[model samples]
Structure formats: structure tokens, C-alpha cells
Target chain A: MKSFGSIRRNFAPWKDPAAKPYIEFRNVTKIFGDFTAVDNLSLNIYEREFFALLGASGCGKSTLLRMLAGFEEPTSGAILLDGQDLRGIPPYRRPVNMMFQSYALFPHMTVEANIAFGLKQDGMPKPDIEARVKEMLKLVRLEQFAKRKPHQLSGGQRQRVALARSVAKRPKVLLLDEPLGALDKKLREATQFELMDLQQDLGLTFVVVTHDQEEAMTMADRIAIMDKGQVMQVATPAEVYEAPSSRFVADFVGNVNMLEGEVASRDENRVVITGASGAQITVEHSGDVQPGTHVAFAIRPEKIKVSSKQPVGTGANAMQGEVWDLAYLGDMTVYHIKLDDGQVVKASSLNSARIHDDPLTWSDRAWISFTPDAGVVLTR
Target chain B: MQGKLSRFNIVSLVFGFAFLYLPIVLLVIYSFNASRLVTVWGGFSTRWYVSLFSNQQLIDAAWVTFRIAVISATVATVLGTMAALALTRYTRFRGRFLFSGMVFAPLVMPEVITGLSLLLLFVAIGLDRGMFTVTLAHVTFSMCFVAVVVQSRLLSFDRSLEEAAMDLGATPTRTFFHVTLPVIMPAIVSGWMLAFTLSLDDLVIASFTSGPGATTLPMRIYSQVRLGVTPEINAVCTLLIAFVTVGVLTAAIVNKRRDLQRQRDEHAALRG
Candidate 1:
């Protein structure tokens, strides 16, 4: 498995002050009748960046993508593409293309004709259109099925034709709505990488909307987690996963054990928190915090260590508990340990060995421990 | 078990088909009778068919009916398809409910009332009634049936296909011509065929709207039948039945072939 971080190393244009945003949404809000689908939200996407809008259904991600595609207009704000206002421009006039979730290929046309449709719309020469169509067919690896109609092809083939047709015109931006959502698991996983590679090869700014977090994490350079038509946090996959900004983000992205507590003591580099269950958790932190402030310490299951015996050095970060449940997932085992104070803490350990020498079973007394930097202290 | 039908099912199927086709079979078999009377068959002969061809008045009426059916069906198909598109696409326009209700009103309205109202309107407008008036009346009533057929198709139409066309830089007009029209063509064709058949067989509306020298086949046959029952009438009826049966069978075959092609394509897609 190829790591996503290594594919686009040192690509942080958002952090650079001089790098002007290629696409800017300035306080865009869209309301349909009595329902507000997209609230007043602003976001900036750089050129050639694979940006993803990640959320559950009806979180305004699709609305934002539609606004960019010119299928919809923002009610009260402006959308700028390459320093030009996109307001009042019809979808046909805009230099943006979208691949619909339904893979809306013209059913009457062959694959070649479907790909040639946009090029012909621009009144490109007939020869040029044919050449472009041929190139797109080759690009998406559908050259052999160029003459087949959409109904004659498989689902994945139809998806590729839709992609080819949308990108054949070389639009300034390509918007994809739930691009890989219809494929089965193995195909979806394979297509995610293909889409990323295609985006990089074309160097077109790609903004994808998907509710699948794994898809967003695998293909997007940056993801914006949205809830109730508002963005909760915007960061890379690692940042959003490792250091979520809120309780919702931590819980929404993946499974996490949230320990509700209040700050017990604070220092320059670390803070100790006393949980509601009377368990103390010490975490590494640098932000200024006052004592007795309420907070939640969020930790992923894989970060904590579970064993039958107590560890030697850990004091405040360790707690004695009984093994409540365990699930063996082939690659790792998750242990749910119930503390004496009636709080269940989940811990997962990698199955690196073929045979376990001493595995903690159900109802066994155990101790769960974590390092100071393993968990994030969320104040909200 | 799967291939064999039960005795009760076989009996029901036989009774259903016999109930529908027995009268038509009797009419068809008697068309070849040599006797002048339609009910009594003296012997087999082609005399009635030969005389039927020489009947100039009947020939002229048939020609007039054919012309009216062709012209009215074509015009109604165009106007009705446009109406269906407007109703289905622009769902929230002003007076939408009223417009849709009016479009569908003719489907359930009494044919006599429609003919009477159209006759009154033509008379009030001081327009002479003839083949022109009959064609106009046919277009008015038959367009609603076309609209109904096309509307149901438009209802199930995937709107994203149009959006995809627009997204690909085609104008709305171009999208309709290139995508929407081609996709709904089957429905439009069936609607036109329906309108043509309805106009060809109409007698009451034609009677109310037509003037002298504009007699249709049904009116001619009705007048001839009132004078006497002739074997010639049975021949003409059989010919009409054969024409309509050929048309309906051709349409069914075309639809069945398209469906089979699509199923084969899907099977190939799955295998590939």
C-alpha cells in the first residue's frame, strides 16, 4: 500500500502568504425555499490541489461543489475563479466541468461521441475533436471500448467514460460528486488511487465531495469536515485524524475513546486531567490552560497499551481495570477494559507475532497505559 | 413445473382470447362471401373486393381520412411533445396546476361535448367546415392523448442527463435536441401512432365538424350500412383491420427487438 503523504511531499501552498488562491468562495450561502443547504461559508482552494469536502449526507458538500460547477449560484456571496467573478455565468459558459454521481452519460451516443461532445461544443475542429477524444480514451484506458454505448459497458467503464467526457475539454476545474461511491469495495479502493494519479497528471484543480472518510483521506491533499452546512475543521488527513479540533471532529472521522474530565494541573509542556470516573490522565500540551477547566481527553484505541500486569514507570497515565471484552481482527486485537470507577477504556494492540505468549482474556485484571503525547486534550 | 401451465390457466387463456377475437374472426371469414347479404355465405369469391376498389366515393373518403390522420397526427405530436416538456421541466411556473389540468381535461371529457363545442366555436367564428375543420378538431382532441403518453415518459426521465449536457457546454436548446429528444423518441412515436389511429377511426367528431365533399371512410360505411348490409362492407372492414393490425404488430416487434437487444447488451456488460 502506497502512503498518501509521500505522494505529494512539501505541497503546502495554503501556508504560503504569496500563493494566491486559485478559487475563492467568499461567504457563500445557498438557501432552497425554507431550508438552508449551505450556510455562510468561505474557503480557498489552490490551483492543482486535490481538495475534498468530507461530511455526512446533507452537510452542504454537494451544494458547494454544485456552486463551483455553476449549476447553482450562491445567494449572498461571490465565487471567484482565477480572479474572475463566477456569478451570473451559466453552467455552459463556465470553465468548470462536473462528473455527476449518476454518471450521466448520454445514452444515445457511443463512448467516443460522449467524450467528443464537449470538444464539439467549443466548436473545435472536427479533427481536433477526434484527436482529443482518442487521447482521453487512452488516458482512461478505455480505448478498446470506444464504440460501445454506455449500456454496453460495465459500471466502472461507464464511470471512466463519464470522467473522460468531463475532462476532455480541459476545464480549469473538475468537480466530482461522490466519484467512487457506486463501485464495490475493491474497485473503489483501486479507483481512488487512479483518480489521484489522474488529478496529478492533468494538474487540474479537483474538488471532490464525498461522505466516505477513507476516500477523502486516501485521495485528497486537504479535507474540510462539514456538519450542518458548516465546516468544523479544514486540515490534512493526518492532522484531522491525529489532532482533531473538536469533539465532533474526533468522533466523526474515526473511533475514539473520549474521557470527559477537568484540568487538574497545568505546566509549560503538559497537563494532568482528572476524569469524571476519578481517573487521572496526563497529556503533553503546549497551549495555556487554567486549572479546574473542564475538558475532554480524546485518545485513539491503537495509541493505548493493554496488558495483564501494570507498567513500571507510568503513574498518572495508567489505570487498573478488568478486561470487559476483546475482539481479534486478524491484524490487531481490541480490548475494552472496564476500570474500577465504571469507565470502559478501549485499547488495541498489533498482532505482530504468530502466537501470543500471554494474552489478556475476558474478566482478567489488567492495566491500560498511554504515553503523555498519545492523546489530545480537547477543551470544547 | 416451470414450463407447463396448469389446466385452469390454459382454460382462462383460451376464454380470454376467444372473447376478444371471435367477432373479428367471424367478420374476416365472411368478407369472402359471394352472396350480397353479409350474414349468409353463399360461396367464396373476390367479387366484393373488386367492387370495393371501384367505388369512387368510398375511395375519396378513404383518401380524405388518410390525409387528415397523417397531417393531424404529425402536428399533434409536435405540439403535445412541447406541452409535455414544459409541464414536466418547469414544474413551478405560474398557473402550472391549471395548465396541467386543462391539458389532461380532454382525455376524460365527453366526445360529444367536445364535438359540439368545436362546431359551435367554428360557426361563431364564421369559418366554413370541411376536411380542414375535421383535421383541426382531430388535432385538438388527439394532442391530449399524445401529451399523456409523452408526459409519463418525461416524468421518468433522468434530469441529470440534461444537466450533464449543459455542464459539457451545450446550450439548453442544444441539450434538448441532442439528448432529450432522442431519448424520448420512442414515446413520441407511439403517441403519434395513437393519435393517427384515433383520428382514422373517428365518426362522431367528423360528423359534427365536416362539410360536403369531406366525407370520411366511417361516415361512408355508416351510410352504406343503413341502406343495406353488403358483403363489400365486410371486405372494407377486414382491410382496415389488417392495416391497423400490421401497424400495431410492427410496433410491438420493434419494441420487443429493442428490449431484447438491451438485455443482451446488459448480459455482455456483466460478463465483460
Candidate 2:
């Protein structure tokens, strides 16, 4: 089995305490009239990191990004880019570029002109600007589409042009607001990997704001889940998925079976709880918690095992249930097991074989079981 | 159902077009008459048209009117586009509402009242009433029309394009010139055309503001019409109508060709 530390081998600057942050937001708060868009938020982003701010709409992720790009000023506190305060700098003078969600390519300019716009603004020599534009076009793999206007290009091609235009100047940091939000599903999936490779190739710090959790999980080195103008959690994808800090993070990231319970007993690394539905739940937790404290035991569906016959020698983590529903996905089968106490538990098993000789069907008596280390105990 | 036109529809169509164009058609046909009288058509001839070219007074008036229209339209387009940019880009400022109300007030005011007010203001300022004052008065009223035309286009403009330009390291002034100006060029051109047409045939305002030397075409035509109508006057009016028709047709053809090109580009993009 692959462990958490092994998955991310060397590129973890955030883990080193001595490493200085490339960008820092210090107690920033932005209030528009009565509505507070960002409320006393602080964050640190490392150099060359592909960071994602993931949240639902109106969660202030875009506002945070705009603030970093110098389009917005924080009502209080300061933002520092490489130790320099970015409070009064205009967007034109800032060494950061943004790829807008609308992919705001100049409709009047051809593809080559659009990509050359930024380099020309810096007053580069004519030959240098032409060479840089050619390099950008080749980087985005649009060699034959230099003369096409934005309207003459396809949506995906326009997206690439927008990307190439923003990065042609090679800013210190690139801010992407919903970069893949405009692409279709298949195209978005393909572009996600391309963006990852490009980020590695350019070696620039990237800050992406997206509402899609799957996109964040696929591309970000670290994901910051935001809610109501506050950062709920910031961690690597594996840590966020396997060990969410709260019930909100657990439910927001993926599907989880959260059993509401109170702590009945505790040991060094194991905590047993009596659920509200009268089922005994045991999970591995090293945190300090008193007995009788209410908590939630969160487990993902794929962590639990469902079988027709009850497994032998299983204790508090095993429960008898009936198969209430099942979904036969091409690569896996998900069973919704209704326990005897009327709580529905979801368990997914991979469909490794082509056919099942004795498959558990609807209303069939089944057993759902998991080990103590499979789930986490959330205090909030 | 598609090819057949009902009798009621055909009758209404004929009546609508006739109501709009019958007088103009009569004027055009009478311009070609060999008779000196406009109402009597004594067969077709180009004699009146030939005589129109030699009428030095009418030619001078036409020249003055053309100069005023071109100068006033160009000035109004520049000022009105600036006003539109200010109104749309800055949504909140002290007295923004009052400023916008004053800018659009001339649009709804009666032309006679506007002309009278402009005449009073020019006289009060000790400014001579001549080609300059007349151009100034036309610009005052026609620029409001230009503002309204450009304001509607600015409201629907995507502001992110400007922001993108700024983010790409261009200054605000450069962004406006390179991005905003080009994107809004069509609206600005149309606004200029509208102002030009408004200034071209204006009679009341021009009469109020013109001095002894600057007699415009509309003022001359109105004075000549008081006497017996002549085929020479009809010929002049016909030429004016032909100029306007050609202008309108060229604009329409240009717009249609642009739209067709856009459609073809979109189709090619879709196929790819």
C-alpha cells in the first residue's frame, strides 16, 4: 500500500518551517457596503506551488484571487508578494497576471496579436516580441492558428489563446479563475493535465480558484477549502480526502457516511462511540477527547466492505444490515446497506471479476464491516 | 402559405410605403420635368438639373451646410464618446445622476426651444452668430443623440477585456486606446453618422444661429419655397435625397457583409 508521505516525495516546501512564503495574506478583510466578501482571512502560498482555492459560489475565493492580482484592495491588513507590500500597486504594475473566467481575449486581434499583446506592452524589441509570441504559440500548440481571430477559433482554442496571452510575459505568479470552468467535461479533463505540465515547465507559482472539487483534487498541490469568507482547511489532496478535519470538509470533498455518536470509551489510538442509531462505532484517533463527548465518525464508501455472510471475529465495527440499493458501475458496485437500527450505510466494492456467482441483491441480509483505521473522528 | 400574400396585407403594405414615400417620389419625378413649374410634368429632361449647378447662391448654401455637418459631427462624436465612457465606467461619483440628466436633457427638449436657448446663450456671451455659432448649436443638440447611441453600447460591453489589457501590463490609457476603442468602434461610427444626419438638414437651429454670410441649404430652400415652386428646387431636393439614400445603402451593405463574415467564421470554428 502507498503511504501518504511516499505519494509526495520531494516537492513539499510548505512542510519546511524555515521556507519563506512567496505570497502572504495577512488578516485581510474586504467589506462592500454591508456584505463582507472576505473577512479577516490569512493564507500563505509557497513558491512554485500549484495552489487551489476551492469553494462554492460567493465563498470569496475569486475575491481573494482578485485581491492578490491588485484589482481589489483589502479594507484592512496587507498582502505581501515576495516580502513587498502590494497594497497600493496597480494591476498594470504588479508582476502577476490573471486568466479571467471569461477568457477575455481581445476580439479584434488575431491569435498571434493576442499572445503578443503583453510582450509588446513591456516595449520589447520588435524581433524579441515576434520570437516570444512564436514561442508562446508553440507552447500552447497553436502554430497554424496565428492569424485567426478569437471568434474564428473554437472555444477550446480560444481558451488556449487566453492562457498563452496571460503567460507570454512570464509573470512571477499566474492567477487562474475557474480556468476549466468554460470547457466541456472531456476537454476539461484533458486540459487539467496540460495545465499541470505547463506549470511544471514554467516553474511559476500558480493560484487557481475553482468551485469544482474534482478539478482542485486533480491539479492542486494543496487545496484550501473555503466557506463564508473563511479558510476551513488547507492541506494536500491525500490528507484532505483521507483525513478531513471537520464534517463540513468531509461532506464537501466527497461522499462520506457520517455516523453521529458520542464517545463511550477511549484508548491511546482507538476511540469507541455509541451512535445515535444504537450502533457501536470504532475509529482510530490519537487526539485527546473525553468520554461522552459528541463527535462524528466519518468514513468513505470505498473503505467499508459489504458481504452476503457476516464475517467471523468482528466486534464493534461490524453490523448486520440489508441491501437497500445497489449501483453497478462499470468498474465497481456500490451497495446502500440499511442497518437494523434504520441507518443507511454505503459500501462500494470493486468489480474485479466479469460475473458474480452469488451477488447480494435488494433486501438481502448483508454484513458491513471496516477496521478501526478506516475512518476519522471529527469533533466539529 | 409562404408565397401567398393576403389582399389585406398587400393593401396595408402599399398604403404604408405610399404614405412614407409618395411625396418624395413625386419630387424626384418632377425634378426631371422639362417644364419650369413643378406640378406640371412636360416630359423628362435634365434641364433643371443643369440649371441647379449654376445657381451660385444655392451652391454656396450647400457648401456651408456640408462644412457645418462634417465639422459638428466630428466634434460631437469625440465629445459624446468621452461622455459615454465617463458615465458607464464610473458608476458612482458625486452628482453623477445630475450630470447624466443634464447630458440627456437636450435629447427630449423641443428643437425650437433648444435653438432659442442656444441663440440666447450665444448672444449673452457676445459671440457672433455665424457658421461657428451654428456649428456649436448643432453640436450641442446632436451630441446628446450621440451619447444615447454610444451609452447603450457601452452598457453591454464586457469590462473584463479592459481589465485583461491592464493585467497584461498596459497602462489605463493604452488599454482604452488598444482594446476599448477598437471594440466600440462600430458604435462610435454609427453615432457619428447619426449626428451628421441631424446636422445636415436642420432648418430651425441653423436659421436661429446663422449670420448674413452663412445661409444653409435648408434655410435657402425654405425661403425659396415661399415663392412659386420651381423644378430647380425639386432637382436640388432630389439630389439631397439621392445622397442620403446612397449613404444609408452603403451602411446597410457594410453591416450585412460583416454579419455574413462573422457567421462564416463561427461555422468554421464549429466544424473544427
* Best-fitting candidate, scored by TM-score: 2
Tens-digit lDDT string for candidate 1 (B1-272)? 78899998899999999999999998888899988778887899989899999999989999999999999999999999999999998999999999999999999999899999999999999889999999999999999999999999999999889999999999999999999999999999999999999999999999999999999999899999899878888889999999999998998998899999999999998898
What ranges in model 1 sit over 4 Å off? A1-7, A314-316, B1-7
Index of the highest-lDDT prediction: 2
Under CAPRI classification, how is model 2 graded? high
Interface RMSD of every predicted model, in angstroms: 0.6, 0.6
Show pairs that collide, candidate 1: none
TM-score of 1: 0.97
Candidate 2 chain A: minimum summed lDDT over ten consecutive residues — where? A1-10
Minimum summed lDDT over a 10-residue window in model 2 chain B is located at B35-44
lDDT of 1 by residue, A1-380 (tens): 52223435678898899999999989999999988988989899999989999999999999999999888899889999999999999999999999999999999999999999999889999999999999999999999999999999999999999999999999999999999999999999999999989998999999999999999999999999999888899988988898898999999998899989899999898998998867687898878779999988899999899878888785437889899999999999999999899989889999999897887899999998889988789986
Give Cα-based local distance difference scores for all models. Answer: 0.92, 0.93
Assess chain B of each prediction and give its TM-score: 0.96, 0.98
lDDT (Cα, tens digit) per residue for candidate 2, span A75-126: 9989999999999999999999999999999999999999999998999999
Per-candidate TM-score against the hidden true structure? 0.97, 0.98
